[model samples]
Target: MQKYILFTVLSAIFIVFVGMGIIVPILPIYAAELGATGFALGVIVAAFALSGGLLQPFVGSFSDRHGKKGFLITGLLIFGLTGYTYTLASSVGHMVLIRTLHGAGSAMIVPIAMAYMTEISAGKNVGRYMGMLNIAIFSGIGAGPVLGGFFLDLWGRNSAFYTMALLSFLAAALVALVLPGRDSLTIEEEQGSMLSVFARMLHHRKVMGILLARMATMIIMVPTFAFLPLLMTRHMTASGTEIGMVIASRTIVNALFQMPFGSLADRYNKNRLLLLGSTIISIGIFSVPFAVSFVTLLLLFALIGLGEAISWPAMGALAAEEGHLYGQGSMMGVFNTAMNTGIFVGAMGVGALVDVLGIAWAFYLVAGFLFSSAIIAAAMIRPRKKTCISTGDKS
Candidate 1:
């Protein structure tokens, strides 16, 4: 029964993400066709991320005291309804407004769900469990573009938008019916403010180092993927199917490899793997500007996907361990905030680069950034001297 509940919840989450993912290869082009400039298009992507990132900490902190289920349900409702709003957007402003609402909904769901999972799966092989969520995440996202691109080829933009709306509503319905309501928020007044907890987390060398590495990971990812499709379509004369396949290649590799690497993280030195993975991703990103064929680009994306599969599961295990020590919701909030921040900054910044320097420069600059950030992470994120410690918390 518990297994069924878990599967249902995960499935619900995955379905909604398929909705979200369907827009990936389509949205930027849609915005541009609606008379948005390069910078405006970047803002379109960044707006959602900015709202999501900024709201996550506060919402996560609140959920720690209130209940995750309420926020999860409410957020999914907003998320579901907002997809239809995209079809109605006539201006960049309309898109931004819808994106802002969508971002808020995103902030509430994933991190809170993560906190719930981490808390429940205590003392288990957390990496493997958390990595399962990646399967749902990647598969939904992977499949979304494939279907979206097909719909675009057949019906047009509105069809894809409507599909997104339908899936979000489906996810909302599933969660309402299937997921258990466990409002087990056990916060004492003496535990200090969320700000204070954040301050402590900030000062903890291990936590901060991990956080920095995670932040860097997203900084490299968000911009590259956001802009790569644009380059593929414009420069390579790629079809929607080709573009979707190239993007989905990464997602497919990510979904396939997560659990295996996650299991390995339980037995191996995760910090080393993180460093190595970052380096591999850098290689993939740097090689992108040189690819002239669809097959080559697809292989490169797969390389990046392999790196992500290797590193993220390890990162998740470490994050789950830390969330247990601090406050689960708070830590997961910060963890997610790092992801959104990267999306926001990377989208905006890379958009500017695309406008000013060129698409090639955007690729080159992000690759350099990825390599440099990996170096810094390798230098900073050292393992603790003692092993098998009960708590991953540091003061």
Candidate 2:
């Protein structure tokens, strides 16, 4: 591993994510504390995703042409600034406006870092490196909630915000000192206008296929987060602690297995892994109605986590390889856009579905949609075709 590039980037990302996690579990309650109603609270939560989704592609394309470090540093600063200002938000409306800007900061950071990661890593190890990067995310996700609870209990709300601000500042300073300056633009990426660049990247059938699958994967995943707790508590009589345990189990599995699964993507058939992993996730989701017992429910959620561990490394590897062929930053932007869009659409759309069609049918619809996408992914990106598509890497 290149300690300066990979380790430093990972450290910055992990710390940023910890800040993110610290705010997430408490944001709604904090909004209510500020007199936000249900709909207002939803708006406060969605603001970040709305802004992030809109900005991610542009940030990515620009970074490819100019440099990643500047945007990365700027994003961290925005995040740190937002963390500090969070202490000043007096009402729900204030938080919503601040959170919207906060989303842009979040958008700018991760994809560019991903592009930089690919820029520095060996081609053969893209999957492994990406998997390693994901650990920072997983660790942050795991740590954030526990820490959020602790901070709220002990240090108070304002202290958590200050601590988060401090972490983001530390992250920014580390990246500024450690990572290299501007990257040289790739020949393939440098030739086109912004609109044309996106057109060319999206024109590839495989890119569309992979991106759609990525979106669909998030759709399935989000519904679990949105609806599962409701079902567990309302029907199964599961306690809040039990519900949290089940959720944490998924995060733990994902964090633990990402590296091993990433290693497998490097060593074996990526499409086969994608196929198998999606199938496992589908199985877990489709059987959710049957998870009557607490232990059984936990196992199902674990299966979903296991499938995520197996599947996402391959998805990320393919995206990086495409970025190598076309444009690293732009392609990563598209990938991130797919993620945010999925979170937004999945949460809203499936929440609607649950009201009209009922939970069982909602799970089936999402699972079926997700399961079929694996076929599209496999059919569109064949092994030989994948090799043939790399016209030339001019990096």
Candidate 3:
């Protein structure tokens, strides 16, 4: 059961992200062509984050009582179908609506996948399993931009969208055909209303600390993925392919380091790792505006990736530990909500900063926010005694 669940979930997520990735390098440029200003771009990104964040806790809690496979399939199908709608968007409003729908699909997928994985993993090795999951995620994302860029440079912008649609559909099909049904996999646990679960979590200091730290760290995503191409265009000459390569550099490095760092997370102090990792990320983001050449930007992004690699698995393990008490689906749902909230805040904040000051200020401001979060995390998160959960030995 563990082997089957791991393989199916990882494979599905990889394909879905690859489809998602193909658009990251070009989506902002596409939006701009439709007459979107900096703030308009932020609106589009925030719309997705907001819609997705709102749905996660409910979907997660419901999945805990019901079954996960159905929601997973439905979400993947929604995700695949939404990719085609992007090509039909004629105005920024249209784009925002489509992205909102996309976020709904997102609300169903990754968090549920994390919940499934946590359920089947031995408690002592949560970080190691999470590391494996991250490798699939980072690897797909790392490969995606390059392919998107290639399609854009060779065929046209629309080609990338069409390819994304195809890949997403394939992923949905993969999950439906291979993963076991609800009865085979669902683990019954005591679960309450989503709101009740959320209320309890809000009062739990360690969980709040983890959620805040996750949100703060993720705030850099908007500037890094959505605005980096704009920054590159202003600073120096860059092609679509070059922009894709720079983005890929970070995720690829992150994928490469997930295992070793995951092992460290299992053995060492997770909070210290979080601090060390966030500090590194802050330094990398702060240096972004200074990068004048492609190589320089690539190296800086790679440094950020390394920081994430060290921190991400540790964070995942902590969340999984908490999942043992709160229920995995419910815990991951709220966890991912914090992630979306960070991205939404970053999108709005950075977009306004770019319009008011310049693109460079966005990077500077996010770096400062992340550094501040590291301090708060240090104060709130403490080392916990390890406990192991058994994975039933079943085929």
Candidate 4:
């Protein structure tokens, strides 16, 4: 039953994210066509992150008490609708409204799915389980960009958006028809109110470290995802396929490395591993402005992906370990909220920086922030203590 649940949940996630992946490279270009400036682009992405970040905790707490399947299904349906709605947008403001709605739908999906997966795992080898989930996510995302590029090049922009809608709807139907109506594990009513739980979590050193690390790592998204396409267009005049391949490189590398890094997370000092990964990511992002060719950009992005692959399972495992103390749904909600908030900050900050200091400086600033956060996270995460047997005779 657990295996079945994992498989079903992962399938739904992969399908849904493939739809999301399909739009990633295309969204900036589409928004650009609607006269969106760098600030406007950031506003659009930040809107999604802010709305999703705000709603995630509440949604997670609600799912903890009620059930996860319903929220997951509803989120997928919303994604589908949002994809189609993109075609109807005439201005950046319209996109912001649409993205805000899309974010609400997002608040229901990934963190809820994470909670459900964690619950079924029985808290053992959590890194491994999260690695599997990441595989589904990264693989779907990896595949989507390639297809999105193809669709855009051959069938035009609307075709890509239409495909996103179709894929999301299919994912929703899969979850509705295939996944169990309720999770195998049950949550007790005495888990406490959301505010109290959050207040307590905020004071916990390890949890705070994890949240900060997550937020800091995510701060690079706007510079990488939202601005990279623009950079490539202006610098290299890269084709859509070329752009997709560059983005896909990072995701594919991350997906490919998940299991191995996840295993390492279980065996090593997770905080140290996370710090190492973040440093690598910072270096990669910092080097972006120096890339003179498409190949260099692809390589740099892949390097970033490798860094993420190392960091993600470690982060996921830590969150899962913490989940036992503070309801899985709530913990993942907080965890993902940190992620969204990071993106929100990145989008707004980087967008404005691009307007003032230029895109290169924006990457430099984000990279600096990531490195600083990584150092702080490493300092804050508690090291595991070793157990030893005592000998009667003294040496």
lDDT of 3 by residue, 260-374 (tens): 9888988988888888999999999999999989999999999999999989998888888888878888899999999999989999988987889988998999999999998
Q: Candidate 1's residue-wise lDDT over 95-167, tens digit each?
A: 9898899999999888877776666565478778777888888888888888877877888888888888888
**What TM-score quantifies how close candidate 1 is to the native fold?**
0.93
- Model 1 misplaced stretches (Cα beyond 4 Å): 184-190, 384-395
Where is the poorest 10-residue window by lDDT in model 3? 386-395
Clashes of 2: 0
Arranged by TM-score, best first = 4, 3, 1, 2
On the 0 to 100 scale, the lDDT of residue 204 in model 1 is: 78
Candidate 4, 1-395: lDDT as tens digits: 77778888899889888888888889999999999888889999999999999999889888888888899989999999999998999999999999999998899999988997788778778888899999999999898888888888888888888888898899888888877777767663547888998888888888989999999998988887799888988888888888889999999999999999998998988988899999999999999999999889889989999999999999999998988888898899999999999999999988988988887987899999999999998877865454487533111
Candidate 1: which pairs clash?
Answer: none
Model 1 Cα shift for residue 362 (angstroms): 1.6
* lDDT, candidate 1, at 370: 71
Q: Weakest 10 consecutive residues, lDDT, candidate 2?
A: 182-191
Instruction: Give the C-alpha miss distance for residue 225 in model 2, angstroms.
Output: 4.8
Off by over 4 Å in 2: 28-45, 85-95, 153-159, 184-189, 224-245, 286-298, 351-365, 383-395
Clashing pairs in 2: none
Mark the regions of model 3 whose C-alpha exceeds 4 Å error after superposition: 186-188, 383-395
State TM-scores per candidate.
0.93, 0.83, 0.95, 0.96
lDDT of candidate 3?
Answer: 0.87
Reference-based lDDT, each prediction: 0.80, 0.76, 0.87, 0.89
